[model samples]
Target: MGNRLDRDQVVGTALELLNDVGLEGLTLRRIGKELDVQAPALYWHFKNKQDLLDAMATEMLRRMNALQEREQEAEGGSGTGTWQETLAGSHRTLRRVLLAYRDGAKVYSGTRFTDTSYAIPMERFLAPLVRDGFTPGEAARAFYTVYCFTIGYVIEEQSAADDPGRGVKGIDVAERAERLAEFPLAAAAGAELFGDADAGFEAGVAAIVAGIAATRERGRKVN
Candidate 1:
């Protein structure tokens, strides 16, 4: 009498509900209601909330991978760029996807993907570094550095934008100014320091990529 509910369908609906209710409000019952399915049906697909969240996180990564593919296709499929550009592009794409959903970084941070499907995307990110003369361990570390930075950046960015008081140390502009008054340079630069989140993210990522490249170059010369 009704369309069959599947794992993909469930996860898709959960992501939709995530945007509406945020991670804190996202629950199986809410997703089931969104799908017009009974709790038992949802249970058949996911044993618990964590299972469903993992699926959602996996789906988020899938979407990020799809976006990168589209970007490469638009750029004539070669994906030609320096290692820094490639890594920055991937990190930026992740930030975009995480910001698309409400509390997406929070959801993704909590998930542990056990699916083999994640391997392809993981390799897509890591392979470039390895090919650029990074050891496998170095490539993994580099990728993790960028990945962790993006996640942490988005979590703070979203929190600051959504709930100002919930952000880092709850320091508002006035409070920051007050706290830094004793330090002239810090007081003068407080606004600039906290002024543009996007600029800060870009600057930080660029610095990290450049640092990694410089380190690798030094290693090559030393060897």
Candidate 2:
């Protein structure tokens, strides 16, 4: 049996099957069937579904890192950006990667990383922020703030995007406008909230960055 599969191979198979069976339906036994092996084989690599999930999230992080590396290479390395831009851009790539797979954002969120694959790139982005006056803790919080924003946004985005495929209802702006017409402000807000996803995401990033910057300035005054 091909039970001698490595961790990455196991994770790759799981992600491939993720699109078809989706997160809830994915299983080690199902993956073994696909690999033509006994379920024990997968256990050699993953002791539990959560273990497998952590590895899968790490693999996703690796993919995000690889894309950033390529972008740096294309720009002749040591790619330039302010700390805010750098942080925002990292999560933007994360959003793209998460959106690439069915329930990808769901798979990623709340899953722990199995390795230090995120360390290097995370360090790269955190450096400028730390040097610019934010403490390591503050910088980490900022990164996480944007990271959570990206994940939450993509989760909603995926839900909305998936509705049509499964004949489900989604964020129908026109319908919302009509239903909430009694409250003109609430009705009009739908156009901004769900109308232009790209713009909405950027606006969120900008607002978060601005908040971080404001906190940093306040800290400077206190010091």
Best by TM-score: 2
Clashing pairs in 1: none
- Name the lDDT value of residue 143 in candidate 1: 82
- Give the Å shift of residue 108 in candidate 1: 1.1
Instruction: Compute the lDDT of residue 105 as modeled in candidate 2.
Output: 91
Q: List lDDT for all candidates, in order.
A: 0.80, 0.84
> Judged by lDDT, which candidate is best?
2
Query: What tens digits encode model 2's per-residue C-alpha lDDT throughout 68-104?
Result: 8998788886755788878888888898899778889
Residues 36-140, model 1: lDDT tens digits: 877777877788999888888999988988888988888786765667877898899899999899888898996888587778777777777777778889888
Runs in model 2 deviating more than 4 A are 1-5, 164-169
Output the worst ten-in-a-row residue range by lDDT, candidate 2: 160-169
- Candidate 1 has what TM-score? 0.86
Over 4 Å off in model 1, which ranges?
1-5, 161-183
- RMSD, each candidate, Å? 3.0, 2.6
Q: What TM-score do all the candidates reach, one by one?
A: 0.86, 0.90
